[model samples]
Target: MKPCPVLSIALALALGLPVPARAQSAPGQGGPTVIRARDDALYRELGGQEAIRRFTDDFYDRMLKDARIAHFFDGINAAYLKGALADYFCVSAGGPCDYDGVSMHNAHAGLGITKGDFDALVEDLQQAMDAAGLPFATQNRLLARLAFHHRDIVTR
Candidate 1:
Protein backbone atom coordinates (compact mmCIF):
# COMPACT_ATOMS: atom_id res chain seq x y z
CA MET A 1 0.00 0.00 0.00
CA LYS A 2 1.21 3.51 -0.89
CA PRO A 3 1.06 6.30 1.65
CA CYS A 4 -0.85 9.50 0.86
CA PRO A 5 1.42 12.26 -0.50
CA VAL A 6 0.31 14.81 2.11
CA LEU A 7 0.66 12.30 4.91
CA SER A 8 4.13 11.35 3.76
CA ILE A 9 5.19 14.98 3.61
CA ALA A 10 3.82 15.67 7.07
CA LEU A 11 5.59 12.68 8.50
CA ALA A 12 8.85 13.69 6.90
CA LEU A 13 8.59 17.19 8.33
CA ALA A 14 7.76 15.89 11.78
CA LEU A 15 10.59 13.38 11.83
CA GLY A 16 13.14 15.76 10.36
CA LEU A 17 13.18 18.01 13.42
CA PRO A 18 16.67 18.70 14.73
CA VAL A 19 17.98 16.07 17.15
CA PRO A 20 21.26 15.14 18.85
CA ALA A 21 23.18 12.38 17.11
CA ARG A 22 23.43 9.01 18.96
CA ALA A 23 27.20 8.61 18.32
CA GLN A 24 29.45 9.06 21.34
CA SER A 25 31.99 11.87 20.93
CA ALA A 26 34.01 14.35 22.93
CA PRO A 27 32.64 17.91 23.32
CA GLY A 28 33.27 20.09 20.19
CA GLN A 29 34.15 16.99 18.18
CA GLY A 30 32.70 18.11 14.88
CA GLY A 31 35.15 19.52 12.37
CA PRO A 32 34.48 22.86 10.75
CA THR A 33 31.82 22.47 8.07
CA VAL A 34 32.58 24.00 4.71
CA ILE A 35 29.57 25.64 3.17
CA ARG A 36 29.29 25.64 -0.61
CA ALA A 37 28.45 28.93 -2.22
CA ARG A 38 25.02 29.01 -3.80
CA ASP A 39 24.30 30.35 -7.25
CA ASP A 40 23.55 34.09 -7.34
CA ALA A 41 19.85 34.76 -7.20
CA LEU A 42 20.44 38.33 -8.40
CA TYR A 43 21.77 37.16 -11.74
CA ARG A 44 18.82 34.83 -12.20
CA GLU A 45 16.33 37.45 -11.08
CA LEU A 46 17.76 40.29 -13.23
CA GLY A 47 17.76 38.03 -16.29
CA GLY A 48 21.58 37.99 -16.52
CA GLN A 49 24.16 40.20 -18.23
CA GLU A 50 21.98 41.88 -20.84
CA ALA A 51 19.47 43.03 -18.27
CA ILE A 52 22.27 44.26 -16.01
CA ARG A 53 23.69 46.30 -18.90
CA ARG A 54 20.33 47.87 -19.63
CA PHE A 55 19.74 48.69 -15.98
CA THR A 56 23.15 50.34 -15.64
CA ASP A 57 22.48 52.43 -18.75
CA ASP A 58 19.14 53.58 -17.47
CA PHE A 59 20.55 54.32 -14.00
CA TYR A 60 23.33 56.53 -15.33
CA ASP A 61 21.00 58.27 -17.75
CA ARG A 62 18.78 59.19 -14.85
CA MET A 63 21.72 60.34 -12.75
CA LEU A 64 22.98 62.59 -15.53
CA LYS A 65 19.60 64.24 -15.83
CA ASP A 66 18.82 64.50 -12.15
CA ALA A 67 19.96 67.81 -10.72
CA ARG A 68 20.49 66.31 -7.29
CA ILE A 69 23.48 64.19 -8.30
CA ALA A 70 24.56 65.68 -11.61
CA HIS A 71 27.31 67.79 -10.09
CA PHE A 72 28.99 64.75 -8.62
CA PHE A 73 29.15 63.12 -12.04
CA ASP A 74 30.10 66.30 -13.85
CA GLY A 75 33.14 65.99 -16.16
CA ILE A 76 33.01 62.20 -15.81
CA ASN A 77 32.93 60.43 -19.17
CA ALA A 78 29.51 58.92 -19.63
CA ALA A 79 30.78 55.88 -21.52
CA TYR A 80 33.45 55.17 -18.89
CA LEU A 81 30.92 55.66 -16.14
CA LYS A 82 28.51 53.26 -17.81
CA GLY A 83 31.19 50.64 -18.30
CA ALA A 84 32.37 50.92 -14.73
CA LEU A 85 28.82 50.61 -13.47
CA ALA A 86 28.26 47.52 -15.59
CA ASP A 87 31.42 45.93 -14.25
CA TYR A 88 30.47 46.74 -10.69
CA PHE A 89 26.97 45.39 -11.10
CA CYS A 90 28.16 42.28 -12.88
CA VAL A 91 30.52 41.40 -10.03
CA SER A 92 27.92 42.45 -7.49
CA ALA A 93 25.29 40.10 -8.93
CA GLY A 94 27.70 37.15 -8.85
CA GLY A 95 28.33 37.03 -12.59
CA PRO A 96 31.69 35.82 -13.91
CA CYS A 97 32.71 39.38 -14.84
CA ASP A 98 35.73 40.93 -13.13
CA TYR A 99 35.73 44.61 -12.17
CA ASP A 100 38.97 46.33 -13.08
CA GLY A 101 37.80 49.73 -11.91
CA VAL A 102 39.52 51.53 -9.08
CA SER A 103 38.46 50.80 -5.54
CA MET A 104 35.85 53.09 -3.96
CA HIS A 105 38.38 54.72 -1.65
CA ASN A 106 40.77 55.45 -4.51
CA ALA A 107 38.06 56.35 -7.05
CA HIS A 108 36.39 58.97 -4.90
CA ALA A 109 39.35 59.87 -2.70
CA GLY A 110 39.53 63.52 -3.61
CA LEU A 111 35.97 63.97 -4.81
CA GLY A 112 34.57 65.13 -1.47
CA ILE A 113 31.40 63.07 -1.86
CA THR A 114 28.75 64.00 0.69
CA LYS A 115 26.05 61.94 2.40
CA GLY A 116 23.37 63.70 0.38
CA ASP A 117 25.14 62.79 -2.84
CA PHE A 118 25.45 59.18 -1.75
CA ASP A 119 21.81 59.07 -0.74
CA ALA A 120 20.74 60.51 -4.07
CA LEU A 121 22.74 57.91 -5.93
CA VAL A 122 21.18 55.16 -3.82
CA GLU A 123 17.72 56.55 -4.53
CA ASP A 124 18.45 56.52 -8.24
CA LEU A 125 19.72 52.96 -7.95
CA GLN A 126 16.52 51.93 -6.22
CA GLN A 127 14.55 53.53 -9.04
CA ALA A 128 16.62 51.69 -11.59
CA MET A 129 16.06 48.37 -9.81
CA ASP A 130 12.33 49.02 -9.66
CA ALA A 131 12.28 49.95 -13.34
CA ALA A 132 13.95 46.67 -14.10
CA GLY A 133 11.13 44.89 -12.22
CA LEU A 134 13.40 43.34 -9.60
CA PRO A 135 11.73 41.80 -6.58
CA PHE A 136 11.90 43.83 -3.33
CA ALA A 137 14.10 41.30 -1.52
CA THR A 138 16.54 41.07 -4.40
CA GLN A 139 16.76 44.83 -4.69
CA ASN A 140 17.35 45.20 -0.97
CA ARG A 141 20.00 42.51 -0.94
CA LEU A 142 21.92 44.15 -3.78
CA LEU A 143 21.60 47.55 -2.19
CA ALA A 144 22.70 46.26 1.19
CA ARG A 145 25.88 44.90 -0.33
CA LEU A 146 26.55 48.26 -2.00
CA ALA A 147 25.69 50.20 1.12
CA PHE A 148 28.54 48.63 3.06
CA HIS A 149 30.96 50.53 0.85
CA HIS A 150 29.44 53.92 1.46
CA ARG A 151 32.15 54.89 3.94
CA ASP A 152 34.78 54.19 1.35
CA ILE A 153 32.88 55.90 -1.46
CA VAL A 154 31.63 58.92 0.39
CA THR A 155 34.28 61.34 1.56
CA ARG A 156 31.99 63.61 3.51
Candidate 2:
Protein backbone atom coordinates (compact mmCIF):
# COMPACT_ATOMS: atom_id res chain seq x y z
CA MET A 1 0.00 0.00 0.00
CA LYS A 2 1.13 3.49 -0.69
CA PRO A 3 2.16 5.27 2.48
CA CYS A 4 0.13 8.21 3.68
CA PRO A 5 1.90 11.43 2.79
CA VAL A 6 1.56 12.72 6.30
CA LEU A 7 3.28 9.69 7.76
CA SER A 8 6.37 10.29 5.70
CA ILE A 9 6.41 13.95 6.58
CA ALA A 10 5.77 13.26 10.23
CA LEU A 11 8.99 11.29 10.46
CA ALA A 12 11.04 13.98 8.82
CA LEU A 13 9.63 16.89 10.78
CA ALA A 14 9.79 15.05 14.07
CA LEU A 15 13.45 14.45 13.46
CA GLY A 16 14.07 18.17 13.04
CA LEU A 17 14.92 17.71 9.41
CA PRO A 18 13.53 19.04 6.19
CA VAL A 19 10.78 17.08 4.47
CA PRO A 20 12.17 14.22 2.45
CA ALA A 21 12.67 14.56 -1.27
CA ARG A 22 13.44 12.21 -4.13
CA ALA A 23 15.61 12.21 -7.18
CA GLN A 24 14.64 10.84 -10.58
CA SER A 25 16.97 9.98 -13.40
CA ALA A 26 15.97 10.14 -17.03
CA PRO A 27 16.68 7.09 -19.15
CA GLY A 28 19.55 8.76 -20.99
CA GLN A 29 20.37 11.57 -18.62
CA GLY A 30 23.64 11.65 -16.74
CA GLY A 31 22.22 13.49 -13.77
CA PRO A 32 19.25 12.96 -11.50
CA THR A 33 16.59 15.59 -11.05
CA VAL A 34 15.66 16.45 -7.49
CA ILE A 35 12.00 16.89 -6.66
CA ARG A 36 9.76 17.02 -3.66
CA ALA A 37 7.93 13.75 -3.25
CA ARG A 38 4.88 15.18 -1.59
CA ASP A 39 3.34 18.61 -1.25
CA ASP A 40 1.66 17.62 2.04
CA ALA A 41 4.73 18.18 4.20
CA LEU A 42 3.18 21.25 5.80
CA TYR A 43 0.14 19.28 6.87
CA ARG A 44 2.25 16.52 8.32
CA GLU A 45 4.71 18.92 9.84
CA LEU A 46 1.77 20.52 11.64
CA GLY A 47 1.25 17.08 13.21
CA GLY A 48 -1.91 15.96 11.43
CA GLN A 49 -5.43 16.29 12.87
CA GLU A 50 -4.61 16.53 16.54
CA ALA A 51 -1.92 19.15 16.11
CA ILE A 52 -4.07 21.14 13.72
CA ARG A 53 -6.87 21.15 16.25
CA ARG A 54 -4.54 22.45 18.92
CA PHE A 55 -3.19 25.09 16.58
CA THR A 56 -6.67 26.23 15.63
CA ASP A 57 -7.68 26.43 19.25
CA ASP A 58 -4.62 28.44 20.08
CA PHE A 59 -5.20 30.70 17.09
CA TYR A 60 -8.75 31.50 18.14
CA ASP A 61 -7.62 32.03 21.66
CA ARG A 62 -5.00 34.50 20.51
CA MET A 63 -7.38 36.17 18.12
CA LEU A 64 -9.96 36.63 20.86
CA LYS A 65 -7.41 38.43 22.97
CA ASP A 66 -6.21 40.68 20.20
CA ALA A 67 -8.31 43.82 20.10
CA ARG A 68 -7.55 44.45 16.46
CA ILE A 69 -9.18 41.30 15.14
CA ALA A 70 -11.29 40.12 18.01
CA HIS A 71 -14.27 42.35 17.22
CA PHE A 72 -14.68 40.75 13.84
CA PHE A 73 -15.61 37.49 15.49
CA ASP A 74 -18.16 38.96 17.84
CA GLY A 75 -21.05 36.60 18.47
CA ILE A 76 -19.59 34.08 16.04
CA ASN A 77 -19.70 30.35 16.57
CA ALA A 78 -16.26 29.35 17.78
CA ALA A 79 -16.69 25.65 17.18
CA TYR A 80 -17.81 26.10 13.63
CA LEU A 81 -15.07 28.60 12.91
CA LYS A 82 -12.35 26.32 14.24
CA GLY A 83 -13.65 23.31 12.34
CA ALA A 84 -13.85 25.24 9.10
CA LEU A 85 -10.39 26.67 9.63
CA ALA A 86 -8.92 23.23 10.23
CA ASP A 87 -10.51 21.89 7.10
CA TYR A 88 -9.28 24.87 5.13
CA PHE A 89 -5.74 24.53 6.43
CA CYS A 90 -5.76 20.81 5.81
CA VAL A 91 -6.66 21.25 2.17
CA SER A 92 -4.38 24.25 1.75
CA ALA A 93 -1.44 22.28 3.12
CA GLY A 94 -2.22 19.34 0.80
CA GLY A 95 -3.51 17.11 3.56
CA PRO A 96 -5.84 14.25 2.73
CA CYS A 97 -8.93 16.08 3.94
CA ASP A 98 -11.83 17.89 2.35
CA TYR A 99 -12.73 21.51 3.03
CA ASP A 100 -16.41 22.27 2.51
CA GLY A 101 -16.18 25.91 3.50
CA VAL A 102 -17.08 28.79 1.25
CA SER A 103 -14.48 30.41 -0.96
CA MET A 104 -12.23 32.99 0.72
CA HIS A 105 -13.99 35.88 -0.98
CA ASN A 106 -17.43 34.57 -0.11
CA ALA A 107 -16.44 33.83 3.46
CA HIS A 108 -15.14 37.35 4.06
CA ALA A 109 -17.80 39.06 2.01
CA GLY A 110 -19.64 41.86 3.81
CA LEU A 111 -17.16 41.58 6.67
CA GLY A 112 -15.34 44.74 5.59
CA ILE A 113 -11.93 43.25 6.24
CA THR A 114 -9.00 45.56 5.59
CA LYS A 115 -5.28 44.98 4.97
CA GLY A 116 -4.55 45.88 8.57
CA ASP A 117 -7.06 43.30 9.71
CA PHE A 118 -5.48 40.73 7.45
CA ASP A 119 -2.05 41.50 8.87
CA ALA A 120 -3.41 41.19 12.37
CA LEU A 121 -4.87 37.81 11.55
CA VAL A 122 -1.51 36.67 10.26
CA GLU A 123 0.17 37.90 13.40
CA ASP A 124 -2.36 36.07 15.52
CA LEU A 125 -1.73 32.89 13.60
CA GLN A 126 2.01 33.24 14.08
CA GLN A 127 1.58 33.72 17.78
CA ALA A 128 -0.66 30.69 17.89
CA MET A 129 1.95 28.60 16.13
CA ASP A 130 4.61 29.79 18.48
CA ALA A 131 2.46 28.88 21.44
CA ALA A 132 1.84 25.50 19.91
CA GLY A 133 5.62 24.98 19.59
CA LEU A 134 5.74 24.75 15.86
CA PRO A 135 9.12 25.35 14.24
CA PHE A 136 9.64 28.79 12.77
CA ALA A 137 10.31 27.41 9.29
CA THR A 138 7.21 25.28 9.49
CA GLN A 139 5.18 28.27 10.61
CA ASN A 140 6.50 30.34 7.76
CA ARG A 141 5.67 27.66 5.23
CA LEU A 142 2.10 27.37 6.43
CA LEU A 143 1.70 31.16 6.58
CA ALA A 144 3.02 31.50 3.05
CA ARG A 145 0.28 29.25 1.77
CA LEU A 146 -2.39 31.11 3.73
CA ALA A 147 -1.04 34.42 2.51
CA PHE A 148 -2.11 33.51 -0.99
CA HIS A 149 -5.72 33.94 0.10
CA HIS A 150 -5.19 37.39 1.59
CA ARG A 151 -6.06 39.17 -1.63
CA ASP A 152 -9.38 37.41 -1.67
CA ILE A 153 -10.00 37.69 2.06
CA VAL A 154 -9.33 41.40 2.48
CA THR A 155 -11.81 43.53 0.62
CA ARG A 156 -12.16 46.69 2.69
Candidate 3:
Protein backbone atom coordinates (compact mmCIF):
# COMPACT_ATOMS: atom_id res chain seq x y z
CA MET A 1 0.00 0.00 0.00
CA LYS A 2 1.05 3.58 -0.55
CA PRO A 3 2.07 5.57 2.48
CA CYS A 4 -0.62 7.71 4.07
CA PRO A 5 -0.28 11.34 3.06
CA VAL A 6 -0.96 12.48 6.59
CA LEU A 7 2.51 11.46 7.81
CA SER A 8 4.39 13.21 5.03
CA ILE A 9 2.27 16.35 5.18
CA ALA A 10 2.61 16.52 8.90
CA LEU A 11 6.37 16.15 8.56
CA ALA A 12 6.43 18.91 5.99
CA LEU A 13 4.45 21.22 8.23
CA ALA A 14 6.67 20.35 11.15
CA LEU A 15 9.66 21.03 8.93
CA GLY A 16 8.48 24.57 8.16
CA LEU A 17 5.87 24.35 5.40
CA PRO A 18 2.73 26.37 6.00
CA VAL A 19 -0.69 24.80 6.35
CA PRO A 20 -3.75 26.90 5.60
CA ALA A 21 -5.68 27.89 8.66
CA ARG A 22 -8.77 25.72 9.10
CA ALA A 23 -10.75 24.22 11.78
CA GLN A 24 -9.44 20.68 13.80
CA SER A 25 -1.41 7.38 19.03
CA ALA A 26 0.49 5.50 20.18
CA PRO A 27 0.95 1.81 20.80
CA GLY A 28 0.45 -0.76 23.48
CA GLN A 29 -1.17 -0.88 26.87
CA GLY A 30 -0.38 1.95 29.26
CA GLY A 31 -1.74 4.17 32.04
CA PRO A 32 -1.71 7.19 29.73
CA THR A 33 0.30 7.53 26.56
CA VAL A 34 1.10 10.59 24.49
CA ILE A 35 2.31 10.31 20.92
CA ARG A 36 5.79 11.69 20.39
CA ALA A 37 4.95 15.01 21.91
CA ARG A 38 7.08 17.72 23.45
CA ASP A 39 4.20 19.99 24.44
CA ASP A 40 0.44 20.62 24.24
CA ALA A 41 0.62 23.04 21.37
CA LEU A 42 -1.74 20.93 19.35
CA TYR A 43 -4.11 20.59 22.24
CA ARG A 44 -4.28 24.33 22.52
CA GLU A 45 -4.68 24.72 18.80
CA LEU A 46 -7.54 22.23 18.92
CA GLY A 47 -9.32 24.39 21.49
CA GLY A 48 -9.07 21.90 24.32
CA GLN A 49 -11.25 19.03 25.53
CA GLU A 50 -14.69 20.42 24.84
CA ALA A 51 -13.83 21.24 21.26
CA ILE A 52 -12.17 17.93 20.79
CA ARG A 53 -15.28 16.19 22.01
CA ARG A 54 -17.40 18.13 19.56
CA PHE A 55 -15.34 17.21 16.54
CA THR A 56 -15.08 13.61 17.59
CA ASP A 57 -18.84 13.44 17.72
CA ASP A 58 -19.06 14.93 14.30
CA PHE A 59 -16.48 12.47 13.01
CA TYR A 60 -18.45 9.48 14.23
CA ASP A 61 -21.60 10.80 12.65
CA ARG A 62 -19.86 11.03 9.33
CA MET A 63 -18.31 7.61 9.69
CA LEU A 64 -21.57 5.95 10.54
CA LYS A 65 -23.17 7.37 7.45
CA ASP A 66 -20.31 6.44 5.18
CA ALA A 67 -21.04 3.19 3.35
CA ARG A 68 -17.44 2.26 2.66
CA ILE A 69 -16.62 1.82 6.35
CA ALA A 70 -19.90 1.87 8.18
CA HIS A 71 -20.01 -1.88 8.45
CA PHE A 72 -16.94 -1.84 10.67
CA PHE A 73 -19.02 -0.31 13.44
CA ASP A 74 -22.07 -2.51 13.02
CA GLY A 75 -22.17 -3.94 16.51
CA ILE A 76 -20.41 -1.06 18.25
CA ASN A 77 -21.93 1.40 20.65
CA ALA A 78 -21.98 4.86 19.15
CA ALA A 79 -22.10 6.95 22.33
CA TYR A 80 -19.39 5.02 24.05
CA LEU A 81 -17.19 4.89 20.99
CA LYS A 82 -17.54 8.59 20.37
CA GLY A 83 -16.45 9.36 23.89
CA ALA A 84 -13.56 6.96 23.61
CA LEU A 85 -12.53 8.54 20.34
CA ALA A 86 -12.65 11.97 21.95
CA ASP A 87 -10.35 10.81 24.67
CA TYR A 88 -8.09 9.15 22.16
CA PHE A 89 -7.85 12.26 20.05
CA CYS A 90 -7.34 14.39 23.12
CA VAL A 91 -4.44 12.24 24.22
CA SER A 92 -3.10 12.09 20.69
CA ALA A 93 -3.08 15.87 20.44
CA GLY A 94 -1.04 16.16 23.64
CA GLY A 95 -3.91 17.22 25.86
CA PRO A 96 -4.33 16.37 29.51
CA CYS A 97 -6.35 13.25 28.87
CA ASP A 98 -6.05 9.82 30.34
CA TYR A 99 -7.09 7.51 27.52
CA ASP A 100 -7.59 4.12 29.02
CA GLY A 101 -8.90 2.57 25.83
CA VAL A 102 -7.84 -0.45 23.82
CA SER A 103 -4.63 -0.18 21.83
CA MET A 104 -5.03 0.39 18.11
CA HIS A 105 -3.23 -2.82 17.27
CA ASN A 106 -5.38 -4.83 19.61
CA ALA A 107 -8.61 -3.03 18.90
CA HIS A 108 -8.30 -3.64 15.19
CA ALA A 109 -6.63 -7.01 15.29
CA GLY A 110 -9.36 -8.89 13.44
CA LEU A 111 -11.16 -6.06 11.75
CA GLY A 112 -9.76 -6.76 8.27
CA ILE A 113 -9.62 -3.08 7.50
CA THR A 114 -8.16 -1.80 4.23
CA LYS A 115 -6.35 1.26 2.92
CA GLY A 116 -9.62 2.59 1.52
CA ASP A 117 -11.30 2.22 4.86
CA PHE A 118 -8.47 3.95 6.67
CA ASP A 119 -8.37 6.76 4.13
CA ALA A 120 -12.12 7.20 4.33
CA LEU A 121 -11.95 7.40 8.08
CA VAL A 122 -9.20 9.97 7.82
CA GLU A 123 -11.35 11.95 5.44
CA ASP A 124 -14.20 11.83 7.92
CA LEU A 125 -11.83 13.17 10.54
CA GLN A 126 -10.82 16.05 8.32
CA GLN A 127 -14.47 16.87 7.79
CA ALA A 128 -15.05 16.82 11.51
CA MET A 129 -12.01 19.00 12.12
CA ASP A 130 -13.17 21.40 9.48
CA ALA A 131 -16.60 21.63 11.08
CA ALA A 132 -14.96 22.23 14.43
CA GLY A 133 -12.95 25.17 13.10
CA LEU A 134 -9.47 23.70 13.46
CA PRO A 135 -6.81 25.39 11.35
CA PHE A 136 -4.96 23.37 8.70
CA ALA A 137 -1.81 23.06 10.73
CA THR A 138 -3.73 21.95 13.79
CA GLN A 139 -5.49 19.26 11.79
CA ASN A 140 -2.17 18.10 10.36
CA ARG A 141 -0.54 18.02 13.76
CA LEU A 142 -3.18 15.70 15.12
CA LEU A 143 -3.23 13.69 11.88
CA ALA A 144 0.55 13.33 11.98
CA ARG A 145 0.36 11.46 15.24
CA LEU A 146 -2.74 9.50 14.39
CA ALA A 147 -1.39 8.50 10.98
CA PHE A 148 1.32 6.54 12.71
CA HIS A 149 -1.40 4.09 13.63
CA HIS A 150 -2.09 3.23 9.97
CA ARG A 151 0.23 0.27 10.26
CA ASP A 152 -1.66 -0.91 13.28
CA ILE A 153 -5.15 -0.27 11.90
CA VAL A 154 -5.06 -1.35 8.26
CA THR A 155 -4.93 -5.12 8.40
CA ARG A 156 -5.95 -5.73 4.78
Instruction: Give the top-scoring candidate (lDDT).
Output: 3
Displacement of residue 18 (Cα, Å) in model 3 is 18
The alpha-carbon deviation from the true structure for residue 8 of candidate 3, after best TM-score superposition, in angstroms, is: 7.2
**Candidate 1: which pairs clash?**
none
Residues 1-156, candidate 3, lDDT per residue (tens digit)?
433445544563465422322112343452123343456778889999999998999999999999999999998999889988898787776688777677777778889998878878888888888878777667777777776566778889
- Please give, for residues 14-71, the per-residue lDDT of candidate 1 as tens digits: 4432222221222342321111113456566777888888989999988988898898
Order the candidate numbers by lDDT, best to worst.
Answer: 3, 2, 1
Give a tens-digit lDDT track for model 2, residues 1-156: 432323323333454432334333333332322222247878899999778988888898899999998999999999999998887777666677666556666678789998778777777777788788887677767765565455667788
Q: Where does candidate 2 stray beyond 4 Å?
A: 1-38
Error of 1 at 108 (Å): 0.8
* Stronger candidate by TM-score (2 vs 3): 3
Q: Which regions of candidate 1 deviate over 4 angstroms?
A: 1-38
lDDT values, one for every candidate: 0.63, 0.68, 0.73
The alpha-carbon lDDT assigned to residue 28 of candidate 2 equals: 39
Give the best candidate by TM-score. Answer: 3
Q: Scored by Cα lDDT, where does model 2 land?
A: 0.68
